[model samples]
Target: MTETTPYDADRARFTRQAPARLVLCDHAVDVADGAAGLVATEHDPDARPGGRVSQAVQLLELTERALVSAVIYERERGSSWAEITQYLGIGPAEAEKRFAAKLAGWDTAFDVPYRLDDTGRKRIPQLPTAAYDPAWACTQLDRWAGNRLILVDNEHPVSSGLVMAVPKT
Candidate 1:
């Protein structure tokens, strides 16, 4: 037999004067029974940019890397370094040199022919997706949720995944 909940009396007395409501991130919550129409807004006021760096900044860097990596794959798949580098908002020549080296390193390590940089031919390497499409990841941040950190999708790796605050219930 299952034990009875002691709040049986309150269960019968439960009656909400208004529809259930929720306040999302950075929003104010109206207290259902606070004195005189009480409303309160909460925030993560004290930010500890601790550990020598904040997670917010770290996440941004990771996203940028993921974007670069995805662009590299796109280049290997036929996109041009000129186009990709321009899209990445980097100085064409400088970014080209930097990215070419990165892709070549990946190719040598993986023994794949995706990168042709050593041949003086600029091309993309079929790296194992060292990063993900940054734009796709950024879309998920269109909304502000709670301060709690949570992964948006588990199956997708962090390079391809997203992180956001928990939704306020």
Candidate 2:
């Protein structure tokens, strides 16, 4: 017999009540780039080498989420599974099996938007927090990258040349 967690129960009970929002490729790339910048460099003294392993593990998780966001963005833009699978070094069938659930959740979030918490008062977005509020994600990620990665033009925003994918209102 399988044990069902509270999370599973709550997920099943969610209701769709809002318009769908688009998750953009540029924002997802920014998230990955900003996270990569967080990896400590040899010249950075503030980083404690003792905790490097744990920090790297955390960054790995962040990178994986960013990749998921990128895939979702690509799928929304009409990219074929074959094209995406080429980059992952996996067959299309396996790639679809791995990501289909996440892609479904992304689609569902635009319809449901949020669900009530245990208290039945709070609204928790079904979408990943970064994808749910892309403007904030862009601002925070831009700040993170700008602080760590040096650019030739200080005036240029880290997200320059990237177009935001906003849903038509």
TM-score per model over all chains: 0.36, 0.62
Report the C-alpha displacement of residue 158, candidate 2, in angstroms.
5.5
Candidate 1 per-residue C-alpha lDDT over 1-169 given as tens digits, one digit per residue, 9 for 90 to 100: 1222232222223211100001011011111112112123242344443622454455555555555456555554466777777676776678778777766764463344244467755645342321112232223322222222355433333222223224436
Top-scoring candidate (TM-score): 2
* lDDT digits (tens) for residues 1-169 of candidate 2: 1333234333332222111122443444555665666664874576567556656676777677767777776677568999998899999899899999998988776656577789976777776655555545446556665666576355435445344444435
Give lDDT per model, in order. 0.37, 0.59
Clash pairs detected, candidate 2: none
What TM-score should be assigned to candidate 2?
0.62
After superposition on all CA atoms, what RMSD does each candidate show versus the true structure?
Answer: 21.7, 9.0
